[model samples]
Target: MKILCISDQIDPLIYSNTIKDRFSDMDLVLSAGDLPLDYLEFIVTTLNKPLLFVFGNHNLKELPFYRHSFEDRFRFYSPQEERDALTSGAIHVGSKIHREGNLIVMGLGGSLRYNNGPNQFTNRQMNFEILKLVPRLLFNKLVYGRFLDILLTHAPPLGIHDKEDPCHRGFKAFLWFMRLFKPRFLIHGHIHLYDLQDVRTTKYHETQVINAYSHYIIDTGAAS
Candidate 1:
């Protein structure tokens, strides 16, 4: 399946109405967060793509951008919600098991410890959340059905591209998952210009870690 993953910045060049045909062929689009609701609206309404996303720390405001009208583009998620609820007016953490063609995917969205809004997590707190999934949902093959095929998060796992800055912070727990589950792919964003290039597919234990940005595409599977 062709997956168009984007995050961290809003560019008129990409989402603008002028760029219509450039993005129309995508099967789905995943945004890691920090984009405006208008951007989401354009993707679903204008670009004609199925849109899925998590909110960033800055997405909580009642921006004038949305004061004029409302569309079903924006969805809210933290750590607790799950499932695909497009018509339910609910949002998820960009987490949960998803199937795309032959791929099974899971996602973790939000930032590390920050004194801000909407989505944020501290290192230890994030670790605790990770622990909740291990043994309980992720590591237990008997329960989670099959091992995950792909892992996606807004922040990259610690050390690869994470930095303790205002906009980027990796989760230590994600690193723990690397050694534990070792899924096929791990994709993330949030460290904008630090390393804006798409990372060459690298392995964490057995999983391939990729940095999917606004201008990039993460195409996986034997066909890729």
Candidate 2:
């Protein structure tokens, strides 16, 4: 299937009405992280396709909704409204497994813990989080004959497409994950690419690691 993977920055073409014209052949939308909710909502609404996303090192904030008032026309919603909007239509695949047809997606969100930011985890914390998914992965191995097809995350694996800074540093546990689970592809976004000459795809064991910054398109049908 043709997949449209987006993350980090929002493109002007997508915001404007040119997305449909440019990405008309996209079959699925996978959001790695650090994107606005409204942008994701707009893309999902426009494409009318399944959108699966994970949280970056940021939390969802409330949006301004207008009301029919003169002095205070802006309406502030309660906590429930904020919660509902955060999870309205898009699927949060963090720390879980989701299957779309033949595609088995394993999601683990967040980046290395640096400051007291949301969705940031330490090395130990990340390892603990990944341990929780082992049972389910083993189940998939016994049932479907494979552990996973995709490993999606907000940060890249250690020493692979990661920066030197603590915040941009990849999870050390992710190295073990790739060595063990051996997913067909491990797609992540945290390091932003500014130059066209920078490489985005790398091979780790039998898995292909892709940096889904800004936007990327791939065909899972052609993947082995």
Candidate 3:
């Protein structure tokens, strides 16, 4: 299956009329974080595909809309609620496990705690968040023969694609998650790559870590 992953910045190629023609064959859309809701809405309306996303440290004005009710933690938005939220039918999968067909994806959206800010978490907090998903992941392993297929986040894993700065530094818990659950992909967005030569994709153990700075296309062998 073909998936379109976007984050951090808005790409003209995706925000234009030509987007339909450009990515018409994509089976799914995943947003790593830090993108405007309107940009995500446009993609949802244009592509008319399943768009699952997490919240980054920035551009999260609509975050509250996705969390208006505590029940949102267990259920997806109804059709009317989705329209009312004005996210153009996109779904926020932050800190949740979402299953699309046979693909299992878990999201942990936030940056390393550097200051008082929304969507920022300390390493211990992030680890606790992961612990919350243990029961579900274990169930998935028994039923599907794997814990997860994708580990989606706003920050990269420590020492992989992360920087030395506190804000941009990745979570050490993510490395532990990989060692345990062994997801096929750990896709994140936080550090912006300016130079073309800067690395964006790396392989660590059984997972492929990717930086979805602007946009990227991933072709997975899994069924849609």
Candidate 4:
């Protein structure tokens, strides 16, 4: 399967209406976050493929360039909400487990709580958020006979692609999640990279951690 993964910055290549001609061959789309709602909506509408995304820390901030037509400053919906509050036409996978065809995906959005912003979490808060997914993961293991194929998040896992700052620091809980669940791929965004030589992908246990800052393509050979 050919999957297009996007995050952080908006790529003119994908944002252009020509996205259909360029990415028409993609099987699915996964967003790591920090993108405008319009950008996401455009991809979902134009490409006409399954899109799942987690919320970045910036989604809640009031940016001068962003449209205020959205209901509130927040962009992501809670797990308890019946409908998605986000304007993006794609499905939100944050704090949830969703199965797309033969692939199993789990989402954990947000970054370290540097301030009192939404989608930001402290170490304990992030751990608690991860705990909410345990029941679902256990059920998947017991019933579906699988654990996870991808773990989607806004921030990278600790000691992986994360930085030292409080705002960009990776969640320590994510390391535990990867170690426990052993997902084939743990994809994230947040720590932006401008240099080509900077590390992007790393191996952790049986999983491959990818930093999808702007955009990336992944070919999951077979549905495992």
Cα-based lDDT for every prediction? 0.63, 0.83, 0.89, 0.84
The global Cα lDDT (0 to 1) of model 4 is 0.84
User: If both were scored by TM-score, which would come out higher, candidate 2 or candidate 3?
Assistant: 3
Q: Pick the candidate with the highest TM-score.
A: 3
Q: Supply the TM-score for candidate 1.
A: 0.71
* lDDT (C-alpha) at residue 224 in model 4: 28
lDDT (10s digit) by residue, model 1, range 57-122: 566443212222234246554333322223322224354555555555666667876774445778
Candidate 4: residue 21 Cα off by (Å): 2.2
Clash counts per candidate, in order, are: 1, 0, 0, 0
Q: Which ten residues in a row have the lowest lDDT in candidate 3?
A: 64-73
Q: How many backbone clashes does candidate 2 have?
A: 0
Task: Indicate the residue-level lDDT of 168 in model 2.
Answer: 96
* Candidate 2 Cα outliers beyond 4 Å, as residue runs: 62-80, 222-224
* Residues 1-84, model 2: lDDT tens digits: 888998998988777788899887887888898887778898988888888888787543422221122423455568787676
* 1-224: candidate 3 lDDT, tens digit per residue: 88999999999999999999999999999999999888888999999999999999998666766645354467565667556566457788898999987789999998999996877889999999999999999999999999999999999999988999888999999999998899999999998999999999999899999999999999888778
- Number of the predicted model whose lDDT against the real structure is largest: 3
TM-score of 3: 0.91
